[model samples]
Target: MTTYRFSTGETIKHVVLILGALVVLLPFYLMVSTSLKAPQEIETNRGGFLGQQEMMVDGDCVRQGNAEEDCRQRPVVYNYTQAFEKAPLLRYLLNGVIVTVSIFIIQVVVALPCAYALAKLRFRGRSLVFGAVIVCLLIPVHAIALPLYIGLAKAGLTNSYAALIIPWTISAFGIFLMRQFFMTVPDDLIDAARMDGMSEFAIVWRVMLPAAVPALLAFAIFSVVAHWNDYFWPRIVITSSQELFTPPLGLREFKGEMADHAYGPMMATATIIVTPLIVAFLLAQRRFIEGITLSGMK
Candidate 1:
């Protein structure tokens, strides 16, 4: 029989990790809980997780002179319903999908070729260029926000999908990550493709791309999550156009727009916005970990 025992340090480390996970998940828990609870319960902090699910009158329905019974709904139903009905939440979700997808596609298109060149092809100033990419990773988006906004504004691209996606199209981190992963790919593969008379571009698209799927998936998670949840950049550029607003910007609907803050609907909106990301990460968890581990193998 096999015996298993954890050392004191290992046990402590596990405990700390569990505590950290709880801390990170606490806000998400509250968001879902609050969305399920009646407003009174939320105010009183009375409902434990999942809430009592008591029936609540829809204030808007009542205000429209509907009968009280007709307006009544369980807290969960009311919150999630209002999340979609009260604002253009679906439109915002669509915008998020558009921006994230566009940015990721463009980033991959740019990054893959550059990464292949940097990884496989020996050329002058290659080290300097990669070093510059490394330097770019150190520079936060906030540092360049003003200049980027100004440039976009000068080009009359603000308040459009272009504004949301163009600035993010050239991702230094994407380039660096793909470059690292490509470095681990065997040189023999590229040589074999060349021996088959594949052009450089053909080699990148046909040869390198297939083997880089895991790494691409890893980068996709990063790119998609970052752009999907981005509020700051969207808020800056999409001031007047609610149609252009992303999921994060859609949350502003519940804040400062009404006399009583609609915490339930707001939380519901947040839950919807984050659900896709959570689902995607869960599905790709193994591949993501594999990509990260293998990317550094070279």
Candidate 2:
């Protein structure tokens, strides 16, 4: 039997990681605290994580304030309503869904076939083709943003979904990630499927896909987070379209509308925008970790 022990250096590394975690958590703590606080307290940035007392429960809430220390006893929804009414938040959410889902759908369509061919087939220049895909990963989006915008303009796709969808539909990151995942599939299983007369498409659709659930879920998490939080591209491509605003864009617009910035409402809007991504990441995190581990092994 063999025993292994971590070095003093390893212990130092662990302490550093813990310190890094606290650094990461402090901002999140402040944001959630700001969300739950009385409007005045948020403006002053004086609230704690759960905030000053008795303001919230699982059910019913009451408006707080107006007398000496009466504000702590009850809380208000006025800030939240002001935020929502001032902006078309529901439309923003819907546009986000439309753009992200559309991009994800297109990525799946393009990535699977490309991954399948690279992993399981031997065509002329197969290695070369795969290398090209890998090279695309090194090329940043900003490198080609100008050309894409110009191309979209030429095609009359500017200020429309086409401009958004066409530029990001098949992500280079998706291809590289999927190709790495596909390589990890057992060669014997693939060989057996071939011996049993399964076509390439059949094997991909049935056998390979069922086994790649972890990777798919992981990719979904990646795709959703990136597109949902995206602001710069939409800002560039979209013009004169309040209805087309996504959450991040909508939040900026909300900030502009207030004669005086309402810290509580801004924080509340931010909190609401963040919650879905957190829930999504939590649900997929287990599979995402496993999926990413598999890719690294490949």
Candidate 3:
């Protein structure tokens, strides 16, 4: 039998990576486990990961004048059913998709041309524009929230889908990332396209855009995940419009409305809200990593 051993440094690195994985996955484990558990089990913290699956009487059903037999249910069923019944979760999910997709599409439209210009075009103040993009990257979204809100309010755009998406349409990080990736493209390609009598706009769209697919995919993942899980911004802009609530905002509102006894359902709501990004990341993980790696190489 062949035997192999890792070096001491490699062993330590492996240990650290394992620990980090556990730290990241811990919350997901807790959310799903809590969602599966009964209210009593969650409150007492008694059940193991899968819970006992014992049938329990729902006190809320009894309070609403249902018979004891009708109120009996397994914890998992109770939690998931309550999650759907207590809130318009499907609508919130749809809104999340709409807002995230809109933001990503608009961000690409705005960022790509700017990124291409910064990378390929030669003009005065080009460095200044690039420097401004870098500076914008350093500014957190929260810092400009008040000003953005005031402008939206002034325009009567508050509580609209435009309010959710318009502010994120210009992503400085997207521009910076794409610009770096674009810099790695050979000037030979641009010259060849020019030889074909293609305009600068045509080169940007027909040539550069296709080449930047991997980087664009990477940016799409970043933008979608950020906006999908964003609660604070939605809350700030979407007051008085329950219809405009995204998944995170809807989940927050659900938690606030529910009593302490409804912790399972709340966790279930969270699980529903968080599952899409996890699934999407798992599906595109290899591409996402490749994109990040290639973009950074320049």
Candidate 4:
């Protein structure tokens, strides 16, 4: 058989892609590897990729009046166990789920109707409203954080779940994406629903919402990921409330409370926090890509 050969351009492209993949994956590799390594191995940077897999004594456990024999564990076990035990990680995860889901649901509820109106309804100043949405997209959240926080403080919504969920309920990007996708739907569908005596509100829910699934899925991924990984806003709003801390904020608080050398647990916590988004992306990757692509076609 003849040897397979790639063109020079193909070879260069493959090389470039490989390099890019490596660059992106490097931090993930380090995070997992460091999480597996013992404190000594991490400090010395000596254990290689899988780490030594050696039994390590947990100094903190020993100091807590536990027997030395009980304190001895594999580095992986110690790191992960401490990550959960030292903090209310379960509560933090629950709070993350609650906040992320609540934000996504409210965003969809508020955005979908607005998007339908923008796409299908002919009303005065509709163009102005669409322009306002586009302009809001251009304004970074950080620019208005001070005013938002001040308002929340005045309203006494700070230090609660409302603080985390309320500010993010209205997603301009969500409205824009959904609106663009809705614009692509044939007008005949809406006319048919009207012919069947469906109210505009009924048509919005029954006809438009289902048709916009791809875009909604895409927006869901965006909304969930953004809120899930959001530390800055949560940290700002959720002051003095450990019970309401999201995963990122909990991880931050965990780091602050840990000793300087708790890299293993810290890395483990980060890995845990990051894993859900990775899993979600992997599972719905096809839908996610299709959604983004479809939304952009209009």
Please give the RMSD to the true structure for each candidate, in Å: 3.1, 5.9, 3.2, 2.6
- How accurate locally is residue 183 in candidate 2, as Cα lDDT from 0 to 100? 92
After superposing candidate 2 on the true structure, give the runs of residues whose Cα lies further than 4 Å from its correct spot: 1-23, 44-76, 194-197, 283-285, 288-298
> What's the number of clashes in each of the models?
0, 1, 0, 0
Which prediction has more favorable lDDT, 3 or 4? 3
Model 1 alpha-carbon drift over 4 Å, by segment: 1-23, 123-125, 286-298
Worst 10 residues of 1 by lDDT: 289-298
Q: Per-residue CA lDDT of candidate 3, range 162-264, in tens?
A: 9999889898888998999899999999999999999999998899999998788878877777788888899999998988899988988997788878889
Q: Is candidate 2 or candidate 3 better by lDDT?
A: 3
Cα shift from native, residue 75, model 1 (Å): 1.3
lDDT of 1 by residue, 86-199 (tens): 888999999988889999999999999999999999999999999999998888898888899999999999999999888898888889988988989999989999999999
Each candidate's lDDT (Cα)? Answer: 0.87, 0.74, 0.90, 0.89
Q: Select the stronger candidate by TM-score from 1 and 4.
A: 4
Candidate that scores best on lDDT = 3
List candidate 4 segments past 4 Å from native.
Answer: 1-3, 6-17, 286-298
Q: Which residue pairs of candidate 4 clash?
A: none
Q: What value of lDDT does candidate 3 attain over all alpha carbons? A: 0.90
For model 2 the local lDDT of residue 104 reads 88
Preferred candidate (TM-score higher): 2 or 3: 3
